[model samples]
Target chain A: MADGPEEIGRLIGLMARLPGMGPRSARRAVLHLVKKRSQVLLPLAEAMKAVGESVRPCVACGNLATSDLCPICANPKRATGTLCVVADVADLWAMERSQAFQGRYHVLGGLLSALDAIGPDELGIPKLVARVTEEELTEIILALPATIDGQTTAHYIADALPELNVTSLAQGVPIGGELDFLDDGTISAALRARARV
Target chain B: MADGPEEIGRLIGLMARLPGMGPRSARRAVLHLVKKRSQVLLPLAEAMKAVGESVRPCVACGNLATSDLCPICANPKRATGTLCVVADVADLWAMERSQAFQGRYHVLGGLLSALDAIGPDELGIPKLVARVTEEELTEIILALPATIDGQTTAHYIADALPELNVTSLAQGVPIGGELDFLDDGTISAALRARARV
Candidate 1:
């Protein structure tokens, strides 16, 4: 039998399934929620319910949305001609947090994975191609990972859209990165892409 | 502006308030939940709503309950004459997880802390005393922490119930604790409380 009430136990079980949470941490989180029911738990429940009921993938860019288009896509002020292609919505959010990119985005959902039988179609490459002409895109920025699959997906997209100016995020040693701790691949990439101050 | 839709951003903000979760991890969790909406997000939302609406403190023991008494207090098979006193509902739940305590529990809500102005009355010591005669309790086990506040509360409870047998959890090295890693206080306590095999 589970500890506490059945409702609480079920809540804990479901919470444990969330990323970075286990049974122990889930229990702690639940206990914390119970202690602050009005301040946290109730508000959280309402938010989750609202999101679950309303949120859906944006039809144009595949980013999460409440309507047909995402906030970035709906905003007219965003530079529409330059589209940033990301492997996932999380990456899109990360880019948004940086506030460096003022353009729209196209979420690929995932990269090409031969082992998993995931191809260009699965990553919405065709949709991206269609958007190029439909949205009158000038530049397409590839914000994909440096992994093999990511590179393969990038190459395929570039090959498919020969007319568009395609570019990938520059590889370099990160800010505050120590040379001793840097990987050989990263050092080489940084050296190759070195720019003048 | 927040990342993603307003509803999704709101959900992430609330999720960040949970124990062990920060803004970054909360974002990851929200994205994960969105990905598994039917399997995790919807069910989690429903569970939180159910728990928030139905769960309340047990009138008798202060443990979380859906009714007047908690499951332990409601169950007749549990030993009636033995009552375990814990500092919080979380502590009571931890004791239940051990499956070693075969008695009902009394939640103190918190321990005595002069710094915080918490005293016996605030911890429901009077209610516990009343339960002694009402439930015909013979033994009261204190499963409080090893902190100064916990010890002070234990002593206060012991003094309040002069007639009843009041005991505390033994202090020693944990079951898997190595002596080299054990603190001086624990080592001394273990040596003082050494028992014959």
Candidate 2:
């Protein structure tokens, strides 16, 4: 093989590090960029550059933007009093995809992992508390994953902000089928999260 | 919904143009960037920036790199005489993932499409031919898709590079199936690509 440019190699390496991608995908993606030089790659490169030079995160809500404030934070249309506390941006995104909740969001970078030494400070518990008071929030929707890390974080937040209405996202045996053949985990979860029956 | 920053919105817009992504997915991804500001987003933003600033395509094989050559192209170990000709870098990456071939690659960018007015030149057929003549090339493996555009491109390349030992990726009823239940296209392909049987 011949020596490709350093920047392209770096880009490939970086892309390779992304989840679900390796060196080969990075190379293919890079090749596509070159082939579509005038169209896809060039524009994409320009976009990447423009974003690199100007893009920043929102100081308040953790949404991406070209400035200190992301669009959602700047938007007046969002129902200010309702804050949806999410584990990560991906969960926040899932909620956004559903488009069910009209409230704004506060992204906790990750769950409180004792193994990783992530405590309330690391997970931004104080920020949520401050946000509750500053934003005059009424409801805090917990869209965290139903994992140990997620559940632990939810409980921490619920206890910390006892005054606010804290809620967790509902999960069960999914939308279809009977529970007769449900697994132990599913059955237990269904019973625990049961509405009435 | 909140308004994204101008450039951020623009970046999101460009991301939305990528395959398997919509405005909604783009928004979620952007939001992710915002939330993981110090970690994932910052690093990603910087990576995107660095690549944006200097990333360019390999002049010879059309793979992306920060320099004139990509890492694969730059590595002496990968100069295995054999050049795997692919329609795009994605396919090249796929082959790499399988770890099957040890040769370098030539990304054609696309297969010929008459409906879309694509031609040999559009896919850099001339460049591929030029590489064969200039480089001490060996076998030229054709790993194009089985789509109409892919097949048309294959035949065209086979005819053009007759001097090169041209071969095609296997076409069959696929790995886990009986031919009797195959579709018309599959049956036709299986017959056309039939072996001594």
The candidate maximizing lDDT is 1
Error of 1 at A183 (Å): 2.6
What does candidate 2's lDDT look like per residue over A1-197, in tens digits?
23245555665675555444567655655554444556665565556556656766568977555678766777789889888888765666567767798878898878999999999998778988998899888898888988899999999999999888999878788778578777778778877888965
Distance from true location, Cα of A59 in model 1, Å: 1.4
Report lDDT (Cα) of residue A46, candidate 1.
92
Q: What is the TM-score of chain A in candidate 2?
A: 0.85
Instruction: Please compute DockQ, using alpha carbons, for every candidate against the native two-chain complex.
Output: 0.77, 0.24
Model 2 chain A: lowest-lDDT 10 consecutive positions: A1-10
lDDT of 1 at B51: 94
Specify the poorest-scoring 10-residue window by lDDT in model 1 chain A: A1-10
lDDT for residue A152 in candidate 1, whole number 0-100: 92
lDDT per residue for candidate 2 within B102-178, as digits (tens), equals: 77888887789988898888888988898888886778888989887888888898899877788888877877888
